[model samples]
Target: MGSAGVRLGRLKANTSALFVCDIQEKFRGLIHGMPAVVDTASRLVRSAEVLEIPVFVTEQYPKALGNTVAELALPPKALVFEKTKFSMCTSDVDKAFRKMNLDGIGQVLLCGIETHVCVLQTVLDLVEKHNVEVHVCVDGVSSQRETDRSVALRRLQGLPNVFLCTSEMAMFQLAGDSKHPKFKQISALAKEKRPDQLSAL
Candidate 1:
């Protein structure tokens, strides 16, 4: 079983896909810690985009929740799929994933609001149903209650392929190397506090 070969799972930039789940306008404001979630999620999106990762976004019934929060800085043509079910698999999300060509994408990075409901369900579905390796940014997800948030993370931590990462962790993983062309801009984005910083990254 221990063949001497490079483990693909340990390779960086092996996947260029990101799934930002249910950080909708109405829903995110109701989460326990809106500001922190928004800040971290924004940063995660920026890092992913800077690394040229294909972004997949979800809005659980955007007609009802309005739309994803403005802080995300969505690309002009990001794959944004709306769904009624909490699991992104059940909706056009899967189709979007197909379009993104997931076969070579060994990892899927996840960030969003309501850690217990949409984010948790989506992560499980992506792993169990689609077999996508998952990386969750802990600071980017939240719940309406601290207890529920803690419980959700506990549940996700049990998954064999799921890594509970921080915003900084996700950023560096995508960075690949200090020599990556966007390193400086990405570093500056990490310290950005003003709204205008969104466009620069």
Candidate 2:
């Protein structure tokens, strides 16, 4: 978290990946703002597919927790894994992630439930252990309680090499310019009413 920690690099398409953590079926009715969170994650997944960025999905103890929700129709190229640990940095995931690193992956986007738990732990490991710059989808992660989610987000914002951002914002950043070949698809993603736009209840 010293001079070595500042990773303010732009999210280059070729060097970026999206990590969708445990948005499983079991969390459907229990997590706060579940619908909006799913909506955000879906947008990123769709965008990543069009951009050809790698996508990694983790299902927390799927045997008991169930698989990723049906709404998220993953791309054929996505890497999906079952995990019993809170942090998706399990041996398999970490190995694959590191392999991607050797191929130019430098930044990772994180989106899923239990912001303070799995999401938080994953962020710490990515930055501290793997030295990867990470961006968390603020509107794509939730917890059973608002306080927990809010506090976790604030804590994440304070870390070096870790940033909090909305899914739409991230899509555009990865695309970089309107002249990008995938601009049309990325632009379409922005037209929808994103979770961040939801009104006060």
Candidate 3:
């Protein structure tokens, strides 16, 4: 990570948002460790709610790929968008960001499916295009194959503006202090063991 990225590293609830990309129903059977991805992603979503961090979700060609998995208990206020692009930073997504008045938001917590594709592209765009600091939850993202996921993570690490992290790590950082009002609730979410498949990765 670059110095600038580290300088803005603290994940304040007010300036951070969660972006869940393309964790759709059609990918459930095909993606590696689908169950684990959903579990971690859901935990992050719930934690974000506790922190009062806004959540954004995207569906890549929802009509063809189906909607986001039923397992993710998306909040009623979450912004859900449909897109044909691999990157979540599409026109629709941009409009949603503007609509949400995210001009001052500086950090993006990213998760979801096909790490080598949609997730990878989205992270790159968020950094290169929007100039936002991005934290990627490794346990909450996957590909159809382990090698692909590994490669994508490696590439992401090379980006100065992108920080590779686990869901638990990000949540704790967001919480910042043990005395934080939501710390207990958020800490409980991390008690669950990460999936063996993701652990091996």
| Tens-digit lDDT track of model 2 for 98-186 | 99998889899999988999999999989987888999988888899988888889899889888778787789899999999899989
Error of 1 at 3 (Å): 6.7
Tell me how far candidate 3 lies from the true structure as C-alpha RMSD in angstroms. 2.2
Instruction: Decide which is better by lDDT, 1 or 3.
Output: 3
Instruction: Provide the overall lDDT of each model, using Cα atoms, as 2-decimal numbers.
Output: 0.74, 0.88, 0.86
Per-residue lDDT over 113-199 for candidate 3, one digit per residue giving the tens place of the 0 to 100 score: 889999999998888767778999888899999899999999998887788888888999999999998889998988866666484
Say which prediction, candidate 1 or candidate 2, comes out ahead on TM-score.
2
C-alpha positional error of residue 187 in candidate 2 after TM-score superposition, expressed in Å: 0.6
Q: Runs in model 1 with CA error above 4 Å?
A: 1-11, 99-103, 193-201
- Cα TM-score of candidate 1: 0.86
TM-score top scorer? 2
What is residue 159's positional error in candidate 2, in angstroms? 0.8
lDDT for model 2 comes to 0.88
